[model samples]
Target: MDGLRLENEIEGEKTILMLKERRPIRHIVNIPKTRNTFCKGTKCRKHTPHKVTQYKAGKASLFAQGKRRYDRKQSGYGGQTKPVFHKKAKTTKKIVLRLECTVCKYKMQLPLKRCKHFELGGDKKTKGAALVF
Candidate 1:
């Protein structure tokens, strides 16, 4: 049967299994440029306005201990010393928001759920408005 399975048992019992249908959900998220939240900075410990931005990882340093050790092990005419990784499973990355306190200029990071579409400081949505092309 379509999307259905039937199993027969030896004890004269029959079972019916129904497979769940999967649906893809597409949602677009929009965030504002500024936020009002509590700041944990030493100077500003109360609620304050924060500037919001997307957090990006900095460049990796070649002089790090791990990099140095790897480079030293790789130089001596030996093939790949370590196994390369190829088993990546996740398709989307978690979004991180960087919030900076306006008064103290202190920065903090907040992680968000994974989403297919992400928008920062995009246009605001109005109620009862038609979709524009």
Candidate 2:
């Protein structure tokens, strides 16, 4: 607290609304990820050779410490048990488009339309659905 400045302050009430963990990892190049370079065993603290594992679509990550940095729960001493974000967020791709309809040969367009045969954005009933989006 002497030299460090806390940019964002967390209130106890806000924890209920924002239980999910979120990280401000915008780009990869910004991260200080150690590659396959191993510190010399005699001099290095952890003389393990860490391979340059590219971050997949949030898959089974190898970096255990890196993952925990994204989650922080402060409650009564240890704080209340926080909800896991894995249940909420799905496997979303920034570039790739996922179709709700696997059978339909139609493509999900920019301006998603309500097609009787295809579901551009996954709607229960296609009736009266004229591109609600």
Candidate 3:
């Protein structure tokens, strides 16, 4: 049987298999005209508007979901959260510099120096956040 595949972008990289959940046929939806995609023609070197060539429908693993027993949780395994504890509680990760995304307008903290692809440019702020030296 054909299973759906899910992919997402994480930290400027594509992340696959974020989560798996089963759903009926209607849940699997595809954007129309996605099959035939064309690049956003632009003369700019890297500023070109991106284009979609193909669309992959995300899916959940049936084998993995079926193995889970929701009914048994009420007896001895029942709990509000999976793992029965805060085994998966999200923790704040340490970062170098904190800034807001210009595109998303969301507060984001990132390492000061690591990846070479990114150039450590000056802040968009004029006075406060902007570094003096």
lDDT (0 to 1) per candidate: 0.89, 0.35, 0.37
Point out the worst 10-residue segment of candidate 2 by lDDT.
105-114
**Model 3 lDDT on a 0 to 1 scale:** 0.37
Better structure of 1 and 2 per TM-score: 1
Candidate 1 lDDT, tens digit per residue, 34-104?
99999999999999999999999999999999999999999978799998999999777888999999999
Query: TM-scores for all candidates?
Result: 0.78, 0.16, 0.18
- Clashing pairs for model 2 are 75-79
Question: Can you write out model 2's per-residue Cα lDDT over 1-133, one digit (the tens) per residue?
Answer: 1233324447743322223444343222221223223333344434343322222254667457745654443423664465656666533323322222222222221222222232222334557777765
Clashing residue pairs in candidate 1 are: none
Best candidate according to TM-score: 1
Instruction: Name the best candidate (by lDDT).
Output: 1
Query: What order do you get sorting by lDDT, best first?
Result: 1, 3, 2
The candidates, ranked best first by TM-score, are 1, 3, 2
Expressed as tens digits, the lDDT of each residue in 19-66 for candidate 3 is: 555533232222221122222234322222222222223596545654
Model 2 TM: 0.16
Task: Kindly report the root-mean-square deviation of model 2 from the true structure over all alpha carbons.
Answer: 21.4
